[model samples]
Target: MGDGRANNPNSHSNNSSSNKPEWLEQYDVIGKIGEGTYGLVFLAKVKSNRSKPIAIKKFKQSKDGDGVSPTAIREIMLLREISHENVVKLANVHINHADMSLYLAFDYAEHDLYEIIRHHRDKVNQAINPYTVKSLLWQLLNGLNYLHSNWIVHRDLKPSNILVMGDGEEQGVVKIADFGLARIYQAPLKPLSENGVVVTIWYRAPELLLGAKHYTSAVDMWAVGCIFAELLTLKPLFQGQEVKGTPNPFQLDQLDKIFKVLGHPTQEKWPMLVNLPHWQSDLQHIQGHKYETAGLHSVVHLSHKNPAYELLSQMLEYDPRKRLTAAQALEHDYFRMEPLPGCNALVPPQPGEKVVNYPTRPVDTSTDIVGTISLQPSQPVSSGNSVSGGNPGRNGWRNKSWQHSDAARCCTASSSTAADKKERIRNGDDWIPSTTEIEALLSFLI
Candidate 1:
C-alpha cells in the first residue's frame, strides 16, 4: 500500500479525505482497490447496509481540464443499456457539478482470471483442476454468448478483465468488467480511428494483426481462445512484443510466434487473408518464412484425441470466419465431457477434484479517497508477471491495474510517439537481420 500497490489488501481503515464529494458521503470510502489511466477505483460499503460492498470508479479529467471523460460516458451509455448476470452491473452513476469529474459504481469483484491463474501457477504450484477449468470456461463463454447475442463485442477481452465475485450470493459468478472498449457491432467499425489499437497484441485476432480495416465480433472469440489456452497451459500460447509508437507499428514478432504454433495462413484456408492491409503490404516480411502448425498439442500437453484440444483448435482457427462464436463454444463437447462444468468456478465441480482457495484482491486503505494520485506512469513492466515473479510473457502485458493494461494504454497515448528506437532496426527503411529479429525468430521456432 505504500507505493499505490495492493500488497496487503486486508488492512482496512476508513481513510476518506475531507474533500470527498457530497454524494460519496452515503458510502464509507473503504480504500483504493485499483488505479488506471482513466481513474481510481475505491472499495466502499453502503452506509445503510455494510454487507453490500461496491467498487467506485472515479474518472480522471482530460489533460485539457475539460468535462467528463468520453470513455467514461461510453462505458456508462453501453452498460446502462445492457443487463446480464455474466456482465458487470453498473449500480450507480454520479457526477460532480463543481469539477465535472464522473464516478461509476458497481459490485466489487474479489478475483480476476489473471490473479486466479497466477495463484495456481505460482502459489499452489499445480494445474487448476480440470473440473474447475471447465466450469470457469463454461461461465466465461456463457457470459460472452449473452454479449455476442446482444451484438456487443468486448474488444479488450483478457484474463484481467474477466472478474469473479468474492463472496455472498454471487460468489464464483464471473462478471466481464471494463466496458470502455466494448462496441456494438451492429455499426460498422471505423478502423484505427476508434482506438489506435483495438485488442491487446497477445490476444488480438489474426485479422486485426493483418490490419483488416473492417473486423467483426470474431475478434472477441479469438481472445477467448487465447484465454482458454492460458487456462489450460498456465502460460500464454502466443507471446509477441508490441512496438510502441504512434500511428501504427507492424507486429512482426507476434505473428511469427503465432505462425510457429498455428502455421502460416494460406489462401486456401483463409481466402480473404490476402486482402487485409497488413497481409498485403507486409507480406514480404511475413510470408518469406513458412511455419508448421504441429506444436499445439505438444505445447499444451494435451493429446489430439482430447475433447478440450478439439474445442481449443476451433477457437484458435486462423480464419476469423472459421472461428467458433461464444454461442457455438458453449455447445462444444469439451464442456459436456466427464466432470461437466458447474455454476461455481471457484469450487471443485466434482467431489474428488481439489478446491482452490484464491487470495482476495487487495485494497489500499491508506490512500485518501479524494486525494490526487500520480498520473505519471513509472517505467512499464514488460508483462503482468513482473510483480508476481514470473516470466515476461509474449504480448508484453505492461501495466497491472484494472484498466491500465497494454490495450487500454493505446487510448490515452494515442497522440504520443515512442522513442526513435526504430532507427536501430532499420537500414535506410529496410528491415534487416538484427539481434532483436534473430531473437524473435528464435522464439518463433521454439
Candidate 2:
C-alpha cells in the first residue's frame, strides 16, 4: 500500500482505495511524519475537506488485548479536558475495532522547537534571535501556567514536544503537545514515584534525580528552564547520559552533570534535601564536591545582572519549593523588558531583524499505516471510550483558553449523561476518544 511518489507532497490527497485500510477511508493520509514510544504519527488531510491538514497518531492496542492502552486513555481524557491557544488542538478520532487500534487527529504543526533549535545550530550556525526566544518562552510558560492551574502536570516537556504552528491564522502560536506522562496532581495524594520515569534526562529536574517522592508542577518548570537555556545557547544545558533499566535506577550521571554547574545542594539551601528517597543512598559519593568553577551564567553566557539569568537560576534550583512556578515565571522581569513577547513568536518586534522562516517538519510516505503494527484481538471498547474530538472554539473554550483548559474542557466532557454518552459512542460504532478529553484520563491517575 506504500505510495510510489513517497516524497511527492502533491500526492498526499490521492486516495487510491485499492488495499487502503477500510478504517483509513476518512483521511487521505499523506505520509508518516514521526514515530516514538507511544505510536506512529501520519500527516493526512481530511478526505471531505482536502484543504484541512491534520496529524493522525496511531497507537497499538494494549498487550493485554484491551482496546486502548491505559496511558493512551489517560492522554485522550486529559486532552479532551484541555482547551488552550498554546495547547495542540485535537480534531477527530478513528478506531479500528478489527485490530483494536486507535487513531487520534490533531492540527498539523509545521515546526517544533527541536527542529527549530537544530536548524539554528546545524544549518544556520547561529543563535536564535533574542526577541524570538523571549516570545517562545513566554508563550510556553503561559501555556504551562494554564496547565498547572488545572492541576495537570506535563512530566515530559522538551524541545521536540513543544510544537509551533505552521502558516495559518494561528501561525507562530506555541502549542504544548504530548501528554503521555501527564496526570492530575492534587496535593496530599499518593506519591508520584510509582510511574518511575518522567521528564527527559537532559531536561529532568534536580529533585527528580535526587528522588523526591512527591513532586509538583515545579518539575515542569525545571524542564522549561532547560528549554529556555537551550534556546539561548542552541545546546542542552545538562546533556546527561540516561541509564536504562527497570524501577528507574538513580541517575548518578545526570545528577553529577547538574551539580557541576549549579554546585552541591546544601542542607541550609534546601532543607528537605535530606528527606529525598535517594538522598543518602545515591548522593554519598558526590556530597563533598563543591562545583563552583562552572556556574550557570558562564555556562549559558548570561550575565548575573540579566533577568533571564535570574529566571534560569531559579528554575534550576535544587529545591523544588524554591523553583519558580509557571505563573510566577511569566510575571518575571525578563518578559516585562523591551521588545516584549508578542502574540506571534515568529514575528519579532525588532525593526531591523527579518522573520525567521522555519523549515517544515519532514514526512516519509513510503510506509502505510494499515499493516504498520501487528494486529491483536481485544474486547469491545467501553462506553465513554470513543472520542469525536470537538472544536475548542465551538465548546466556548477560546475565551478562557489561557486559564484552566483542562477544567473547562472537562466540563463539556461531563456535561453529557452516561446513557447519552454511551448512546453517542454506540451510534458512532467507533472507539475514538479524540480531543483533549482530560476526564477520560482521570481514572488512571491517583
Candidate 3:
C-alpha cells in the first residue's frame, strides 16, 4: 500500500481523481518553516479565513513498506484527544491521495522558545526578562499539568517544542507543541525504555540516564527543571553531549556533568537509584571522587535566595518521588511572589530601554508542498523518525554557553581582533571562529 503512490509530484491537481483530500484543499501553502526527520512543516493560510496562518506538517511515508508510519499514527491519535489553550491546537487532518501522505494542520506560532532565547543571547545582547521567563514557565507547566493528569507523557519537551503565538486572539501565548514522542502511559503496558529512546539528551532525566526500566511523570519534572534553569541563565544547566551508537544506553559523560554540579546520589538520597540497571556498574568510577557541593544557586545566578531558587532545587531532586509535580510547582511561593505571572510572554521593556522585536521564522519557498528535499534516482528518500542528529539551528548545547565565572568570552566587549578571538578561547569560552571570521581573516592575509 505504501509503494502504490504516484511518483510524479504534479499528479495531485484539483481536477484529478488522485488529488488532495477535501480537508487539505483549503490551505494555501505559504512556505516551509521547519524540516524534521519524519515531516516538513509549512506555514499556510486557510482559504476560508485568510486572517490567521497555520502550520501544516506533512509526514513522510513509512520506511518498512507500511501504509503509514506508526509514529505519525501515534501523534495523530494522541493530538486528536487532547486540547488545551496552552497546548498546540490541531485544526484539521488530511491525506494526499496521490501519494498517501498524511498532513496535520495546527495553529501557527511565529516564534519558538529556542529562537526566542537565542535572539536574546546573540542578537539582543541581554538576558530574557525575569517577568517573561516566569510567564513562559507558568504556561508551560499549565499545559504539561494537563497532559500528566490525562496520563500522557510528552516524552519530548525542549524549547523548540514550545511555541508562542505571533498575533491575534492567542498572541504572545506560549503553547506546548510537538507530540511525536508522546505516549499514553498507563499502569499495564510495556516499559517506556522498550519504546526506543525518549527526550533529548541534554534535557533527559537522571533516572533515564541511569537506565531505569520504568519511569513516571517525575522524568518530565526533571526536564522542566533543566528548562527553568536555562530560562534563567540563557544556557543549558547540564549541557551533555549525546553518546551515539546502537544498544548503548548509558551516557556516562552526561551523568558526569550532572554529578559535577549536583553531587553524587546515594541510596539514602534516592532509594530507587540503587535498583537501576546502570547504577551498580556506573557507580564504580565515581564512588571515590569528591564533588563540589554546588546546587541550583551556584549555576543559576539570581539576585537572592528565595522561593524561586527553592522551587528550582525541588524540581531537580534526584529522587523522582521527591520531585515537585507540575501542579505543586504552580502553587510554589515563586508564583506567589509580587508581580504575578502574566498571560503573555512578551513583557514590555522598562523605562530607558528600547523595545526589542525578534525576526520571524525563516521560510524556504523553493521546497514544494510535497516536501521533496531531493528526488534523485541515485539517492532514495529515507523514511526514518524525523529526529535530527547533533545540534540543529541556534538551539541545543553547543549554541549556548555557560557565562559568568564558569566560562568567559573575551569577544563580547573586545574588538574584532584576532587576539580577542584567541583570548576568548583561552578564557574557557568554547567558541569556534564563525564563517564570517574565517572570511575576514583570509581577506586580511590577501
Candidate 4:
C-alpha cells in the first residue's frame, strides 16, 4: 500500500488487452496527456448519442501492493465531496477488474498557471501591469476562499496546481486542481502535518517548514501570499538553495524580501514571531544586523506591482497570526480598488457550435453530462440510457487525445476543426511552445 502505484497491478499493460473492462471497451483511448509519479492521464471519448470528450487518469497498482496510491484515493474522495467553479471537478472513477487499476475522470483544462507564468516572464518583467496581476491574484484568492470556507486546506498551493480554463475573454476562470496533499480541518487547533512533508518547498509557509505541530488555515494563506509575489515578479519569491553556503541556500530570504518591501518587522508589531518554532535558531545569525532589503524602493516595488503594496503586505506578513485570511484578502483594497474587470465572466463559445472529432470513439449521449461534470456523487438519471446500450447525452464528446494533431490548441464550446488546430497553437501547447511564445502572447493579450 505504501508503494507509489495504483491499487490494480495489471493496469500497467496496454489498455487494449483482451481482459479490459466492458465499460472501458467503449472509450477509445487517445495519446497520453500527462504522466505523473503514480499514474498516466489519457484523453478519451465516450460512445453515446452525443459523443463527448474527457480526461481520464489511469492508476496502476503497485506490483507489491494492493491498489492505487492512498494519496490519489484521498484526492478522489475529497474532490468527490466538494463542488465549486474554482475547483476542478472529478467526473467519475472506475476500477478495472482485469488489472484492478483505478481510473479517475475529470474535465479537460487548457493550461496550468505555472506554464502560463513561465511563458509570459518577459511581459511580467517589462512592467508588472496592475490589471493582469490583480486579475490573477483576485481569482486565486477567490478560489482559496471557496476552499477554506469548506474547511479544505490545499497543502500544495502552487502555480503548477492552478490551471487556466479559457483564453482571452475567459482568462480569469482559474480552477484549483490536484488535491493529493489536501486535508479537511475538523478542528481549529489541529496540527498541520499528517506525516511526510506535504507542500512543495517554494510555497511552504515558514511554520510548516519549521515543523509546527498545531497549525491552521493560515498556512495556506501564506502560500497564496507567496504566489501573489511570484505573479508580480515572474520569479519565485523564495528561491532558497537546497544546500547552504552554495551560491544559493535554504534560508528565510523570502521573509527578508517581504520586510525589505514593506519595512522591517517590529517586536511590538509581530509579537508572536519570536515564538515560532525555528525563529530563534534560524534568526540567531541575522539578529541585531541591519539587513539590506532586496526589492525595497526598486521600481518594481509592490507600490507599482499589481494588487497594491498595502494588500500585498498584509498577505506576506511574517507573523502568521497577523496574515490576512482568504476571505479578508478578497476584500482587500487591491480587489476592491479596481475589482478585476469582468471577474465573474465565463468563457464564451466560438462563432458557431461545430463538433470537432478526435481519433477516439464517439461519446455516449444518454448519460447525464452536467451531473458528470460535478465532483459530487452522480445521482441516477432516469433517461433509460444503460451503460451497455445507452446514449451519452448532448455533452457526450470523447476526451480527445492530448497528443492529437490539434492537441496543442484550445477549443471553445463551439469551435470548427480548423479553429481547433489554431486554438491549440494559440494556447502554447504546440510542440511545448517556448517561454518566449507565452511572453509574446501575454504582451499581445494583456
Provide backbone clash counts, one per model: 3, 14, 2, 42
lDDT of each: 0.78, 0.81, 0.78, 0.62
For 30-147, candidate 4 gives per-residue lDDT tens digits of 5466667766677676666244555787775556655568787778878888888778878777754434456787766656667656755743334334565676677777888988
lDDT of 3: 0.78
Give the alpha carbon lDDT tens digit for every residue of 366-408 in model 1: 9867575332223333322235443455455554444645656
lDDT of 3 by residue, 116-200 (tens): 8889878887888777888888998999999999998888889889898875777779899888888888853577778887898
Q: State the displacement of the C-alpha of residue 398, model 4, in Å, after optimal TM-score superposition.
A: 38
Model 4, global lDDT: 0.62
Give the winner by lDDT: 1 or 4.
1
Candidate 4 lowest-lDDT run of ten:
353-362
Query: Of 2 and 3, which scores higher on TM-score?
Result: 2
TM-score, per-candidate, Cα-based: 0.78, 0.79, 0.77, 0.65
**Residue-wise C-alpha lDDT for candidate 2, range 185-267, written one tens digit per residue:** 98535577687588888998888888787889999999999999999999998998999997778888898898888888889
Number of the top candidate by lDDT?
2
Q: What is the TM-score of candidate 1? A: 0.78
TM-score of 2: 0.79
